[model samples]
Target: MEQPTLSRATNPLIDALVLQHLQKRFPQSAECLQRELASRDAAAAAPPPTNRHALLMLLAPPGDETPLWATAYAEVRDWVDGALDTEGARYKPELSRLLWPLFAYTYLELLRAGAREQAGGFFASFHADHALMRRDELNQLSQVSSAEQVDASEFARRLLTSRYEVRLSAFSRALLLGFVAERRLQLTLRMLNERIKLALPETLAPSDGGGPAAVALEDD
Candidate 1:
């Protein structure tokens, strides 16, 4: 089912007001708004087009096609499911650690995609996943709902900019990346590039202490 779209055109006066607000209140993103208008079907009826037919286009400022979070979230969700399934099960414990960060990123991606309401819903639907181990991070992530909120929340900002520590033996990392890459899970690759750092050991030997372990962050 299609999610409702937030952007729209209105009656002439309201349309002008919307344009003015975009240009005046968000000058930096104004160009994106302009390009959004420019790239649409050039011949569509002006005042009624967005309101009538192309609301999803409003969700993306201009060039981006129905922001990735809109549809791809489900794809990425399924991809994660596949990555943790029988074929990839050997790395399940190590890969499991990425879940919390991936969970946080899902919300960010939804926000960046301009699916604010959807982001909230997505978060609510999965809130139970935040167990005792993830309480702090979960609390921090819960405070964020928009792009500005991300900048304001230190934890949210770190989730976006810092490297998520994925502790795994070298062989596991190779297997995971190689499988995803070979399978062409593009969104998973994007997640790795944007949200995590693969933390490996200095030596390839098995951990003297058993297997890899998650080190608590200074804040945690």
Candidate 2:
């Protein structure tokens, strides 16, 4: 079946604010995303387990035309459905595995924002964890490791790289308060993306051939 293409103009004000946060706050992580894009070679793709489907559905951001959530929902949904068959069978993992690495970028940004510290701990609340895992029995979900061997430096590098690539998703990059506070903008964008990706619907991914499609929210 053919799908509707949800394209639009970029919002410079929003983009500019986002960039400002990334440049000033999470400089290192922003750099990493940029580097990965520039190299045209990303870290190895991680295999998707059965539980990921639920994560995608739950974390998906709520939007269809905005760049970050829209693109992320589409990409994540594409990866999950492509992994399953009509009879609900499993297929070997593919390059779509990039999603895991991408989310790792999100995780890094959140750490920079100090989300853990804000909530009185260094990780998300156990309640949030339970909600995310309930989707797949996710008993093994949290136990699973992120795709890359990440550290603070690596996170900063990826984020900066994405900023330079200028193709980042709005869902993944936009956060609460919309950059009123610069200190945590980078991490806030990252976490918002992660949460929205967790809530994505299955209809987001495109069916045509192209590099993975990204929704640019700015109006041109």
Candidate 3:
């Protein structure tokens, strides 16, 4: 694999984050910095983080600059739920499956935007509200309070690297997609595109799941 390069964008957060993020992977990162600095006194190469969490936090969308996280997140949250409520009604139980991933991703978005309180509070309000089978997933997500915690967690890693599979009838999927299309929630759509996969055949998908295995990603 090619070595990853880090950016020195002059953002103060990015500057400070480089060493901490690098040290997580390369324990000798301090020496690495000193050596590099010794040879090239005019410039410094930020050490990249081992995981995406740090980068996501530092590079979170312009939305993070909003004066208040709670207010801004509430708008996004209400918009997501409102869309679901309007478009999801006819799909019955199958459509409801989308909520967990949506809720989970919302918390992540807040966390990525440096809203730890909102992330924790959102998780707290909605975590235990999930169905019995999804308790494990909710628990896994709840462990994540900050980007550092997310970078260190296996489950959180899976949420990014793996897809959340839902066995949905074709019609239900169309309805779900229609709403997402109309609202154009870019972050939500991105999460769904990258983190979600649908098992189209009704016969192949599991009917009930509460374990990590239940929400496990599938390989194509």
Candidate 4:
């Protein structure tokens, strides 16, 4: 028997109609067409390639004395701070507020990891930048040298347990998110996803009003 073959016209509607007709007239070809359709659909639905390096690095056991958390934290923080600092002054205030919470959590995360020396260096390097807004909290947090201290201190415990909220204009939120995604800063992304709560306002009001918006700040 001569088998029927479909001639693809490239028009979705026409192709579907032809496929249906072929299937009805030739039951054997139906299975082949169905498989092809399934393959195409699966390909279309597959997710884009993701950079899993950061996630893997975070989840993998530390095989050496390297302070992965502290290093990741510093890279993410410095990039974010530099990013916001370069933005227009108008959006700077709303976006820059993210730094404080990020800083606090990064420092605490280092301490919790038993990277006391790394944590101290991190604190000293950036504490002054946040001192104006979080001086007392910074001072108190600096005293926390280990995970045991974090558990015992009320201030440290509260910050770790609670989510820090930040509002951002929709545009600002997109810009920030796009930057992180492009950079593949998974640790920073994890922090934003798990620890920070973002409040996105629909419309950013100029002057008087406005709106919008990792490191794998994780524990062992």
Candidate 5:
């Protein structure tokens, strides 16, 4: 077997590219990125699992970001509800599945930032509302007998893109965990979820979940 050599020669360029990509994908994230960097750096020095999850959770919050998260959550729910396939979504199904816990954490983060009472409960209510709205929309469209029914392509585009946006917040968090925390991707996500429960008790609990367990990364 051939040995793989590592190089820091391109590290600077790669870091720049990562920043550029992040900025482009999330224009609003520029403000919080400094904090994100500090967190990432801190996380880099930490041992496995402790700082791992918080770092991943931190990825979604810089510069008032939310759209990507909204899309991603929608997609995740779709998969959960059997509307999409494990293979049909954007990120790897296993990776995506493991990272699902961040959605609740992101909502909790937003709630805490506002200091509204019953924040966790409110966010949970909103999630339920969003789910109902989505179901209703789908059902109404299915019953449309007129030629004025929305185009399938347009419908798909809307669903996929919105779902993509929702999921992006969580995905970025996972990416941060993967690149900075140095944990294997699946373990990183698992760490993120478990950490969320520890870091924000109002947002998540062990029993609040019925999702997939963390899987081993493919290359391992």
Candidate 6:
């Protein structure tokens, strides 16, 4: 079997010898290296990150450069709730699952940005609605009042460092994107784009009008 090329700069003979030794004596190390290489390649092929804040700034009126994040957060929460309430039972449950993550992340972001009072108010306003569903997480997050506290909390670390996965039907996804775009909901758009990994059915067709071929929210 042909060995995979590890690098271009290394001598092939030396590379082959090193790989063979590692594979024989430290098989796990060889496997780890292969996984790392694959991860790097995948990251390289990924698209550039969207500067949602900068885009929001450009869209804002001349005197209002800063986003009213507190207001925007409430708008997104209400819109999502109302939209899902009207959705058919088939898709409503799955779509409604988004609220917990949205609430948690928005709160963390507000705290991270040093908006302690807004974060507290945001928490108070929405905590009851999610209490039954996410009681433990809400409790843990409630204790976090500052950026330092957020960093120190294990729950916050896990939530911030990883993407939450949600499955959505093509129609549901299209509806979400349309509403987000129409409302110019920057915070919601940023959350969907950056933190959520949407899984769509394999049989999705182009004519479905799902914004993108990939199961991701479009930046534009």
Ranking, lDDT, top scorer first = 6, 4, 1, 3, 5, 2
Residue 166 CA displacement from its true place in model 5, Å: 19
Model 4: per-residue Cα lDDT over 35-87, one tens digit each = 44445455442333333453355334445432655565566556545544333
Off by over 4 Å in 6: 1-67, 83-90, 201-220
Best by lDDT: 6
Q: Scored by CA lDDT, what does every candidate get?
A: 0.52, 0.32, 0.52, 0.55, 0.34, 0.57
Q: Clashes per prediction?
A: 0, 51, 1, 12, 12, 0
TM-score of 4: 0.60
CA deviation > 4 Å runs, candidate 4: 1-89, 201-203, 206-220
Once model 6 is optimally superposed onto the true structure by TM-score, how far is the C-alpha of residue 149 displaced, in angstroms? 0.3
Better of 1 and 4 by lDDT: 4
Cα shift from native, residue 134, model 6 (Å): 0.8
lDDT of 3: 0.52
Query: Root-mean-square deviation of each candidate, in angstroms?
Result: 16.6, 17.8, 16.6, 15.8, 16.8, 16.6
lDDT of 5 by residue, 90-132 (tens): 3333334333334433443334355334333434444453343
Candidate 5 yields a Cα-based lDDT of 0.34
RMSD of 1: 16.6
Quote model 2's TM-score. Answer: 0.23
| TM-score of model 5 (CA atoms) | 0.25
Model 4: weakest 10-residue lDDT segment is 209-218
Q: After superposing candidate 5, which stretches have Cα over 4 Å from the reference? A: 1-62, 66-72, 75-96, 115-122, 125-212, 215-220
